[model samples]
Target: MNTTLFDRVSAVQADLLVTFVPSEGAFPESTAWVDGNADGQLSQLRESGVFKGGLAQTLLLPSITQDFAQPVLLVGIGKDAELSDMQARKVIAAVAAQIKSLPYASVALASRALVLKKRTQSEVTALIAQWLNEGFYNFLGFKQDDAEKATKVTDLLIEGDDEAALAIGTATANGSAFARQLGNLPGNVCTPNYLASKAQHFGEEYGIDVELLDETKMDELGMHCLLSVGRGSDQPSYLIVMHYRGGEEGEAPHVLLGKGITFDTGGISLKPGPKMDEMKYDMCGAASVFGTMKAICELKPKLNFTAVVAAAENMPSARATKPGDIVKTMSGKTVEVLNTDAEGRLVLCDALTYIERFKPKSVVDVATLTGACVVALGSVNSGMYANDDAVAESLKAASQISADKIWQMPLNEEYQQQLDSNFADIGNIGGPEAGSVTAACFLSRFTASYPWAHLDIAGVAWSGGAAKGATGRPVALLTRYLLDKAS
Candidate 1:
């Protein structure tokens, strides 16, 4: 898809024209030409109560005159004062849903008509581009029919002059689309080795450096805890690394770690048979890392960045690590595996310890680590835990800008007691209470050397039931954070 910016509405020409109208007032001036060309059809629709410009309200009209653009779309953005970035995104989503299946090859948006409170024109423009791309995303990889795989709009024209904002929005969307594709793949196809190969491909295409550590190498480096999680499966595990150097030499790089359990069946503690198919989405955190790195490569930001993925698969078998098994991490700390299902933290702890060699300025790890987070925050917000308040605040700011919601959870030392073990230095699973907090506490033990934050995206990573697919979350949040840092 191609996105182009136009400075004036008169100069725009497309198969369809999209204009936004506020509920409380008359139509914006940008729609004047269309209204005059259509012989007041927009006003007629409002008068007849066919479209009143309510929030997310939409009305489509056919071409009445030769001069008017065919099939004009009027989307309601509610009142001017109540308008926000999130609301703007909702409006875009509504518009995308309305036009995605239509036969239009090109569409133009009257960007100046959207007046969001406390947001600049550039911000609104970027939001429009980002959400439109996201709304049109459909994973038809497994679809057999050609009709289901046909393309929608091929070109999008916006009434604005901010090309930089347009680029950022489109690049972010491209990265997210990449993440969603990887996340939607079946567990058998998207294994640890597959993820490592994808990282290598990304490195080659984007001019980054890539390295992969197989199970033998990980064992030599004392990553027994991480390796133990994949022992049950025939598939090999990997420690995948990628480096993006956009800043000055010797600058301390920001590190990103992802828990890459390609398919987690709970190992010896086998999960129930029902809904096990969704386990393929366990690697969404790693997908986000790949997505964010792709966006960074496209934008070429002036910052050094490193991404690490602990890729593995957990299954129940003879060689699988059992309950009560104690394994030593790369940090030389001992962990008693009280439950094989608590494997995300096991892989993350060793990866966190291993990244210390990079001497990162700060670290943020993304994972679908706990169901407690889903129960606590639901699917609306990702649960966040950070060892440093400054890092937490920075991520919150980025979340606000990206509209990727995150709620910070308590990381108090009080929860540390739950991870205490009788046989080893710590236990992989905490006692039933505050599971999310204790999981964060476990990862916190290894991240003491740097400013660290943990994003528990178990809830927002994917949907279930009818809308079962990855959301490609936190990619936007992480990209925004890096962009802000680079600027």
Candidate 2:
């Protein structure tokens, strides 16, 4: 969507204003407004059943005789004391969603974000702009491939003239588009081979160096756990590594791990349901890493980093690994597969172990691993389980600043017991209860040897129908993090 920026409220055909007030405060409008109760304020506007607190209300097309400068929209952001960045983003989303059915036209947003914690103005503007356009994205690739669907909004107009905000919107739009490209691509085109090729593209386009380890090479390295999951698929699996030496040469590189399960049919434990095709997004975690790598290049940090992506597809057949099977990981840990569907951990285990070879100063991995994570965090917060508090604290701070909140869950010793196997060193899955925590525990074992964090992104990977595209581009949060730490 095209977006324009202005210094303040402008003389136009449409206007949407975002306001902040104190708790129990009466409704206020900067310009003239219609009161349903005939009362003087927006509270009266709410009393008339016209609008609730912090919501968007549509003013129908102006009557030919109605005298108006522009179609006025007063969006209440609740009391100023209760104002938050999320509320701010949601208010903008509501407005943008409303215009989806209307004609294609430019709509200006007259709003500002509170600079809490004294965040740099550029960071605040960039984050807000990214989220605003994020609301207009949706994945329609699988929907009969219809390209004629015209967006209700052709462009967006931010209220302020701050170059920072404009840059923010542009950067976010690029990120969102990047996410949609990955989220919408069919799994076949996003397999380990394809992803390795994508890494090469990243290197060529951005001057990053990418290394690809094929199945034969992985087999030689004793990555049986990772290979076992991909053995059933005709498509070969691979290990993808990209090095970004933005800092002085020989600097310690921060390592990022991504679980790139291109398509998961549960191997021997196949999934049965309509719309299973959406499983193509199984690789979104890896896609986010690729996107993050590019964004970091664009937002160029002074620190160096390396990223490892374990990219594979899980398909069931005679060659597929089954329940009750045992395999050894690169870390020399034996895993008994209790359920074929629990394959994400299998892939991550080897990937995390592989990162150890790089001897990264610190590590973090992203994955859409567990359904239990969806139950716990829903569509908003991503589940974060970390082995180190210092890393977790930095991540939490970055999350808050980036408006990509992650809630940390306990990764205690007790959770690890669930994965202990009588016949093997560990079980791929623990008992059903606390599946998310158990999965974190499983990953925690591999990470125990390093300063690491795990973000179980089952919930936040896709925004559902709530956002334009199901992909939310979660990397912005961590990107903000590494930049702060490295800088």
What are the Cα lDDT values of the candidates?
0.90, 0.73
Weakest 10 consecutive residues, lDDT, candidate 1? 142-151
Q: Write the per-residue lDDT of candidate 2 for residues 1-487, one digit (tens) a residue.
A: 6666766453434433333322244433332233322234545545665555443334332321234334444555554533356555666666556655456466666544333234555655665567666656655556664554445666666655577546644664566557567867887676788888888888898898888999999999999999998989999999999999888788678888888889988888889876577777777788778777876777667888887889889999899998999999998989999998888899999888888777777898888899899999898888888888888998899887777879998888877888889999999999989999999999888876779999988888875543423464577776777777676
Task: Mark the regions of model 1 whose C-alpha exceeds 4 Å error after superposition.
Answer: 79-81
**Sequence-dependent TM-score of model 1:** 0.97
Cα displacement (angstroms), candidate 1, residue 314, comes to 0.5
Distance from true location, Cα of 179 in model 1, Å: 1.1
TM-scores, all models, native as reference: 0.97, 0.82
Please give the lDDT score at residue 82 for candidate 2: 37
